[model samples]
Target: MTSKARLIYNPVSGREQMPKNVADILDVLEQAGYEASAFRTTPEKMSAQNEATRAAKEGFDLIVAAGGDGTINEVVNGIAFLEDRPKMAIIPAGTTNDYARALGIPRDNIPDAAKIILKNKTRKMDIGKACFNKKTQYFVNIAASGSLTELTYGVPYEIKSALGYAAYLIKGAEMLPHLTENEMRLTYDDGVYEGKLSMFLLGMTNSIGGFEQIMPDAQLSDGLFQLIVVKPSDPGNLLKLMALALNGKHVDDPNIIYTKTRSLKAELIGKSEGKDLPVNLDGEIGGYCPVSFDNLKQHIEFYVGC
Candidate 1:
């Protein structure tokens, strides 16, 4: 029997060339013996999830998420809950394809990416399930929260479309002076840590927001997340830590807390009492904090190149 492939792509993601390349991508899959079809995501929230779920139910042999982290996260959440899920593929057609980079997938090369998909090598990977504000959502890469980190959502659509990832850096630099420490109580695996922190990042993969060294030790199938918490410090000190993080050496700093764990809980305290800490998942605004995360070990089988 011929295998069915469902291609779900975000038309405007990254360079917005997927619409033009759809024919080529489909042709590649067809040449590789797949009965391929494509689905362009709608403007509605969770539309990718809905489409992915429908594809899963209909039993597509392979489900392709052709966009950035947000689109991949949506597709993961869409089909993760099902006991019968299909093999997954990704096309890194986004401004910052951090997840793809970590997996050694070609980001700027479309035909090469399609060729990699045809290779069909796959691995079992972990998935993160976060419960916040009485709602549960899933993530494939990283989940983060802190001051200045919320700027990913503030970059105007026009700016993002025109300047791509540089827009994030420009906005981040502009918001540096506004960085606020988050006072919180965090519990992870039989230990409690309370402090005023600059940022808290939970990661399942080494590459985060295009920074490969941010969580260099993270392993996708490890069933544990690499957590990094930056303690409250002066702006200069914070800048130094940021620089060190670029080389994955920030863990040696006294103000930096790093560990690997299966679960964690974060609660707001001190200055964060009445405010909701903005949370980001896979480069998109997830929600507010007062959240908990659990790793679903080897939850999904994802295809990648050899």
Candidate 2:
């Protein structure tokens, strides 16, 4: 019996071109001897996770996400804790496609990816779980805090849709002058430390927004997350740090501190004086500090190119 494959598509992703490509993907999958269907996603009624759960219950052998990082995030959350999870596949139709990038999925070709999915080769990969207050979720990419997070939140959606990754640089320059360091108390599996930090980034994958800005040595299957901390210092030093990150050389700088850990907890130490500190998870604003992260090792299965 032929196995079923369901494609969850977000119409608004990647300059609003995902829907058409999803149609093409469904046709390709059907030609490859798989029972295929495409579902249009919406913020209100249906979600990628909802679709994945429904498909899994209906006995789908493969669940493919045909959109951006956020779309993949929703799908992963659906299958992460299931007893008999369906194999996951991706068709890179997003701006960054960060998770697909980490898995060696082809960015330019969709038909080829569909063929690989039909082959059914799989690999188990780690997923990171983050908690904020009463909410808990998993992310397959980086979780960041501080100035960069603020910039990510402040950037206009129009600008993001227009310039893509370049929007970050444009917004980061505007927010740099007003950015201030915050006091944080962080504890990991190794130890605890308190300090004024300019930035804190926990990387489960090598890149953020499809750019290798921080944590150059991060690996997805390594069973550890890379923690990078920028100490509070002069504004000039912070500028230098930014320049180094653009070239992917910040990890070698003496002022930056890097470590590998399985879990970490960070708490805001000092009063913000009515200022709201922003934190970002996979490009979405995830609340303030006082958040904790635990590594969910080999929690999700992925399809990778041979």
Candidate 3:
């Protein structure tokens, strides 16, 4: 009997190379003794999530997500809730493969990534779940809201696939001037905090948008999220914090609030009520505010290089 692997990829992801690399991907999997099949996501019909779920139900021994952070999020969400989920693998074919970066996967080389998968080592990792206005989504990397965070999703798909990571910088610059401050009360495992903040991020892994030190102490299997909140500040102060974040020194700054928590409940206050504050999960638009976040520890096993 042969083990089966399902490769679910987004053709438009990253530099649009997955479609061209399909044969090489399958060859690599075959050499590793797995019978592999492929699925290309289509905007008109099936999504990455749907294909992932179908592959899992059909009992694929491995489910490989070949795309960027958004594609990984969709595949993870599709199977994370299933009782018998397949082990996950990555191709890192996206602009910002944050999850892949966290795992030290080769982001630009698909063949090397396939070889890593062939090595077959596995590690248990956490997943982040957010619920808002009766909507729920699962994220394997990070979940955040406020300020210019929504720029991740705002960058048009074409520009992102064309220019890769640089597209985010362009969009971020365009969005920075319009950033909003939200007044909210955050209730976590230990206590409650009420204030106005430019952004708040719940991270399961330290690698986020290329800022590896943003949550330097994050532990993926710990069942807790490293929450970082940026207090309201002038543009100048915010720029300073951005520099501090790159070095993981912002946690001690008075304008920054950092802690570890397993669960968090955020409710809008003051003028933020009824407002459509953007929420992002694993680099995609999740929903609005008044959300609860829970860390699901050791939620999935992945084929990783150790």
Candidate 2 segments whose C-alpha is farther than 4 A from its true place: 31-33, 118-120, 272-276
**Would you list the clashing residue pairs of candidate 3?**
none
Which whole-number lDDT from 0 to 100 does residue 71 have in model 1?
Answer: 91
Cα-based TM-score, every candidate: 0.94, 0.89, 0.93
On a 0 to 100 scale, what is the lDDT of residue 221 in model 3? 92
Evaluated against the true structure, the overall lDDT of model 1 is 0.84
What is candidate 1's CA lDDT for residue 202? 90
Model 3: per-residue Cα lDDT over 1-306, one tens digit each: 999999998998766788989899998889888999999998954399998999999989889899888788899999988999898998898777888888878887888888887787889888888988887889988888887576556788788667766776677666666777989999998889898998888889888776789898998798999998888887767767766877899999998889999999988898888888878888877888889998888989998765
Candidate 2 accuracy as lDDT: 0.77
Give lDDT for model 3. Answer: 0.85
Backbone clash numbers for all candidates listed:
0, 0, 0
Worst 10 residues of 3 by lDDT: 168-177
TM-score of 2: 0.89
- Candidate 1 has a TM-score of 0.94
